[model samples]
Target chain A: MTFGETLAEAWGPLREDAIQTDAYLEMLLAGATAGAAPTGDLPTVEGTALIDPALVGAARALRDALVRIHPSFRFEERLAGRLRAAVDGVALPRAAGDPIPFRSRPTDAAPGPIPGDVVAVGRLSVLAPSLPEPLDRLPRPVLIGGAIASGVSLAGVALVAWRRRPGRH
Target chain B: MPVFGRMRRGAPADRIAVYDTDRAAVRAAGRDPRQFEALYRKYLPQVYSFAFYELGNHHDAEDVTERTFLSALAALPRFEERGDGPSTFRVWLFRIARNAISNHRRSLARRREAPAELADALPAPLDPEHLAAERESVARAWAAVARLPADRRRALILRFVEEMSTAEIARVMERSEGAVRVLVHRALRTVARELGARREGDARQRR
Candidate 1:
């Protein structure tokens, strides 16, 4: 194989099946033996080297380019700080085994529901004091006055509806 | 099973254990936010590097990296370990980073803002004269990389920059292992050809 091809194969992802092969072993041994050689310089493998310095140089240059662009230390610190603040903002569940505090219920908790007669007063349902006597037993003057008031309101609504009816010119 | 057969079947036992540890770490982080710091510290450099290279600028890289981690933290509660190994978390994280980069790019496109040049994104060398001389060549190489199709470019970066295995890359990319191999091979060949052409042009100019 050409030197460029060899380098490419060597640099490429090592397939599991390829790792056990004689060729792979030989390549590994050659690489191990050739350790510390300059980037483009061909290592003296036991066999014919077929090394192309230019191809090796180009590959190294590409590798160098990929390595050159990285996050600065300041950027790392800034990002880490931001991440720490984010973690802190969350009310994370505490680590296990913390003791729970005891508390006592108040003797005067909210008052229970009121006990009284539920009387329908106009549109509202109100809980008020129970009447001492039935509706028929109420004072004659009070009953008569409420009846007159209800009649007046009903008459007023009827009069307005009649006045506003479509056919009434 | 024979050793060769075992090797061919799956990742080595030690590698699998490493991934198992990663999955455990991910689960811990999910359960407890405090545990997330370990994961963040371990992957910060890698994820940041991937972002910087992909976006070709520090500003966008930082933006995407921030969005990526925040999104990861928010979603960690739901991240299930599928026993696909440690690559599951790595792939999952990269997936977030990938989406963030895409959204950033889309927003930039909508605003009609051109991305910063790759050369500008690169840190200047300490030697001023050497940096001045090397700048064009580095820019040319990056420009060629930028010209590649998005998937191809990403595959190349994941393979070379992250130094990921084919299986790991396949997991991240959600592609078949064979397809990843072919994609990386094609990408490397393209880069080689581009560099070769540049060299010839430079030689001609010198003559």
Candidate 2:
């Protein structure tokens, strides 16, 4: 493969813990929006001691670019009207938004993965434990003690009931 | 409600509610195409934004967005909501959008890329300094993102723009969650490098 192709496919670890990068991103985006004011400090993520501040800012910038772009009112309403009419001849109120201007094209237009093309029943998984981890946390001794105590109590109650029989009295 | 409401703590519940609401809307829309308005309004911004970012202009975005809903309305009768994850309705809708975008891309392959003017966004910021800085940053980021390969760019847009979880993105991208992570990681690294390099270059030119 060419160097560009090789570089395109290659990736590095997010941190030693190998926690998912998208999770960190979710945290970063949330943090960036909450703060609003530029802190100049990189957002800290779990399982990583250091993060490149530039990366954080770039992610934020990309998000900002996306957030600002909106469809024109005419187009939105026109489409809404068309869709509304298409549906069982139902006419709906017109839709509207601020008139938008020309914007830059995205570098790539391929949808990557078509959701309909996916027919696999299960997601990719391998070497996962066959059995799930136990959800019960009580220690064996405590369980046994509780069971024995309950059994003894039941026996005593049975004995008392036997002694209180009407024929014996 | 806006496509993505205020990100509150109950996001998971919000997600489930979104799924529940989508299925309900899908059911209603299935019966009556007019009922699809709830869904169209809910997802119009998301679908349009996806196309706008992907296609890079209002014209193509509108086309793809329109095709997506039209196809969705036509296919509503067959859309059976299965239990896979949240936003099955959206996943279904985006699936349609993804296909429409692909077809549109092929048709326009020979055509020039979508025309874009980055200076003015929908609502211009009041402060000139803020506006200029935002435009520069947005331009830098968008250009760097545009440089990415198709899959990587799509992954980044879905992750950052759509704010989808890794699993959800995986579902949308038809890849494993692990693979989607790598795509986003590599894409982010690449975009960061470009952003940093461009910033330094601009500074040097100014000097």
Candidate 3:
């Protein structure tokens, strides 16, 4: 390897980062636009004028010079692998269809609003059935709690009746 | 303006003309999705390079670049016209990249893994003497950068590779311009010392 080769090799990883950046930007922009699709071409020098033209030109020159000087620059594959690993490490947003290992239990899932020990005590209002399913499904926690209270009340009434009976042996 | 105006045509070059035309189209699209895609086609490479250089690793860089454009598009509705609008836009995008890099490093640190070693992992060459010497310098520089106290490395990359102005860096790093300058100075000093040590080792080997 020559000095040029060394410089090129040093700059080698930078190119993959650039290409990935381009792809990502294209995806993000497409997502943003709703209908804008990629032409499947890498963004070219002509498109770079969105930045300062001089700087864009300089950057291109740098990349070209680095690549030419060190044509042996072979870090692209490894860089891509590491990039994938990093994304994995950070955890990308998973597809909704992806299997989740655990589902919440009814009681455990019933944390009353914003999570933690504050108990809400009042007449619970059930949202109208016409409301969206998510909204309709809510307040179930309060409803469950209501059932628990009603059962306790019935138990108390029976106990009182038994205590008051005069026929007790 | 006479001599210069005469030397160069009053009208801009074809590339500039294309850029101005494209920018107009993008601006016209305003809320239109196609217009933003045009903007992406026009500038994706530049944005990507800037993000990649700052973030060091491809994944985070790509994410940052993607998010920068997304945020820019989302905020386009409120993008006010200013005299230096294009320059401001570039700076804004880079600022996003800087923030992303910092956040990436922070999260990685929390996970207790080496922050996905930014330097290429390929074995350094040992063939030619000059190549070996230069590789040593480059490796030492990167190693020094990696070992820098967080604040200094941030300052160094922002100052040198990104070539951002002190004020711009101050905004991104959330430090006073004076503080950023100081941090950069210290970072350079550390890097210089490491490079010098490597050079000395090379000289000793040659003897």
Candidate 4:
């Protein structure tokens, strides 16, 4: 083999495994941080290194380019809150305007055997009192009035549907 | 573990930052979930950054970060310490993040929307034309890096952005150290070549 090929054989493998090179650079950076004269280690890398020093420098600097852009501070805090809630088993609303689901499990939710009562869809069953706490605040009369209106509206729709059945005029 | 003892010339080893174990934090968090704030604050940036780079969007990154932490916090009680080191917890957390990102990607595929490109923001604030030029070059460098294949991009980020050693990166990426090294070497070369080409193109335009 030519002398150049011989040198290639010697250095080819070293360039691939940069473990030592990285160790040296790390130690060099550490030494500089310690306020040593800060001169020795860099030159050693530059002198003996076959790979371009600019390439190595560029690789090191890439970290700065890929710098950790943080989540907004608000996002961080909100996520922390959610994680805390998760730990406590408090079911918080995931999105804005979404009703905070009851923490009660499916087996625990007893939807009464009444028409229009939501059969528990897994953990999502909107059990009457468990969900509509706001309705519980209104005066008893308004709730009664609203329930009567809903029942009337439902019966009217049902009566019209039966009268418009296929066999009826 | 090789300990870098405090350099006693006038100590070449000026003491750096504080050190704490993931194990201790995990154990504390497991006992009282409230203590988890320590681990949450510690790893939020890392997990968020990983998802951001991998998914190339802030919203998805936040989603993944939130999922990873929520899931981790729930699973904390069941977390058995496999070893006496700090990184076992870190590795586990990253694995969780990796899974979350994959699940997200699957859903994203169903939606059929292209993942958004990463925003090119300068790392540090700077002013003046020279500083602007420097930042632009840095942005271009990362853009080149971002265009690399996923494995290569991940390896580069783990090695550089996360400042993980090859061994650590291998465990995180679930690859051999030799594979990780090859990924970095090829990624660097691709980046160098792309940057060189861009420079040549700019020079031609100038002339």
Which candidate number has the best lDDT?
2
CAPRI quality level assigned to candidate 1 from its DockQ score: incorrect
CAPRI quality level assigned to candidate 4 from its DockQ score: incorrect
Candidate 2: residue pairs that collide: A73-A97, A103-B116, A104-B116, A105-B56
lDDT of 3 by residue, B29-96 (tens): 35333344455544555556555544555565566665566555545444433433233444555666
Instruction: Show model 3 residue runs off by greater than 4 Å.
Output: A1-169, B1-31, B38-56, B80-87, B109-116, B121-130, B201-207
**Which tens-of-lDDT digit does each residue in A25-137 have in candidate 4?**
34444444466552243535443366655566556456446677678765775665455445545444453333332222236556653221222433333322212222112
**Leading candidate by DockQ:** 2
The A-chain TM-scores of all the candidates are 0.25, 0.35, 0.24, 0.38
Q: What docking class should model 2 receive?
A: incorrect
In angstroms and one decimal each, the interface RMSD of every candidate reads 14.2, 9.2, 19.6, 10.1
In model 4, state the lDDT of residue A33.
45
lDDT rank, highest first?
Answer: 2, 4, 1, 3
* Clashes found in each candidate (C-alpha, N, C closer than 3 A): 1, 4, 1, 1
**Model 4 lDDT per residue over B49-159, tens place:** 898888877888898998898777766554544433334677778878888988998888453222235544344545666677777776787778778888988888776
Ten residues in a row with the worst lDDT in model 2 chain A? A124-133
**Could you give candidate 1's per-residue lDDT for residues B26-141 as a string of tens digits?**
65565456566678877887888788777777788888988898787766655655665446677778888888988988888443221346666666778888777576666666
Give candidate 1 regions above 4 Å deviation: A1-58, A72-74, A90-169, B1-18, B21-24, B84-86, B110-116, B127-136
Give the C-alpha miss distance for residue B142 in model 4, angstroms: 1.6
DockQ of each: 0.12, 0.20, 0.01, 0.18
lDDT of 1 at B36: 67
Q: Is candidate 3 or candidate 4 better by DockQ?
A: 4
Error of 1 at A100 (Å): 31
Better of 2 and 3 by lDDT: 2
